[model samples]
Target: MKVYSYSFKEGDLIPTQYTCDGLDISPHISWSKVENAKSYAIIMDDPDAPIGTFTHWIVYDIPSNVLELKENFPKKSVVGNIMQGQNDFGKIGYGGPCPPRGKPHRYFFKVFALDVESLGLPAGLSREEVERFINKHTISSGFTYGLYKR
Candidate 1:
């Protein structure tokens, strides 16, 4: 799969709205050329954290045809086209970066194209576990990176 977005260009700044400086919502994401994908999954995390990898967002079971997730989605209601899993914050949905103040950190936003509609994994999984699960099930995948600093 090839992942792209309307919010920002690949390798460009992800915008303050998706960070601690703004609304802290998820930006729109899109992908194409996914092979035999029944659903899509998105995982946003910061590997540069001082302690370990930190998950910023977790979403899955997104209908393959359904592209583009609006900013700040699922804030008060289900967006109807997808389901969200818990992030490192132990909450369901998007959680923007709040890295310890200091130098800049890199956040990876990855998209996975899966052959199955559901991975059948339970919610509230850690970023490490989720990465392992996606590796086992992904048919195609792509990613974008953004940097933020205090």
Candidate 2:
């Protein structure tokens, strides 16, 4: 499995539309070639956050049949049974890159293939909580990174 974004290539600067300077929206993500996965989970984060690793998005319980996530996904806690957890911005769903005024930072868009159908966790979970579940149920993981700056 691999995580990728149509909005930006790995190691490239993410588009402004997906940053605080623009629409502040989540990038369009796509994954493929999953094997024996019953569900998928995604966590988009900026490890370079000034306050330590900051989570920008946490989505879980995605159906294994899913292949791609469209751009500008809803900021809802729950969308069609798929759950969106809170980010560092104190909101559910995505909070795009908003690094401080300095050099560029790396944002990781990580995807996990889980052995279970759902994490059995609730919405509005913190990144650490979601990560615990991801660790327990993950069978495989892949990621793509993008650079961003103010």
Candidate 3:
């Protein structure tokens, strides 16, 4: 479970493109060492969110052969024939970080390697629920973090 992206680096400031400062779009992502994974799940969230856990992005059912997701990928859009679930913004697709106007917040980008090809979930599932679902059937997982401040 390795994660790579053109987005902000771990502990680096998130670009404005995914925040209120820009397009509010999602960054591209790729992975490796799935280790026999039949499918994959991706969840991006901010635990530093003023609310508890805030979902920024949720995607699942990615085919095992896929290695990357392009920039500005939509929540409901399919990449390599994969499907996306709901995010905390109450929409499907990636939502960039928008922390409060003071301290920087940490955004987590988590990926799950699953044994099943699909989780059979609908398009608008929340982050917590998605977390539970992924944890229930994950074979391998890994995560990277990015920071942002408003």
The best candidate in terms of lDDT: 2
| lDDT, model 2, position 50 | 80
Please give the lDDT score for candidate 2. Answer: 0.91
Q: Write the per-residue lDDT of candidate 3 for residues 1-150, one digit (tens) a residue.
A: 778777767678778887867898887777786778988888888888778988788888887777667787755655546777677667778778877799888888888899888887765667676677788889998887778887
Off by over 4 Å in 2: none
Looking at model 3, how many pairs of residues clash? 2
- Candidate 3, superposed: residue stretches over 4 Å from native: 77-80
What global local distance difference test value does model 1 have?
0.77
Which model is ahead, 1 or 2, in terms of TM-score?
A: 2
Rank by TM-score (best first) = 2, 3, 1
Position 74, candidate 1: lDDT: 74
lDDT of 1 by residue, 1-150 (tens): 567778878777778888878888888777775768888888988999987888888887778787667667774213564667778778888888788889888888788888888767666566666667677878888887777787
Per-residue error at 101 for model 1, in Å? 2.2
Residue 56 lDDT (model 2): 92
Candidate rank order under lDDT? 2, 3, 1
Off by over 4 Å in 1: 76-78, 121-132
Kindly provide the TM-score of model 3 when superposed on the true structure, using C-alpha atoms: 0.90
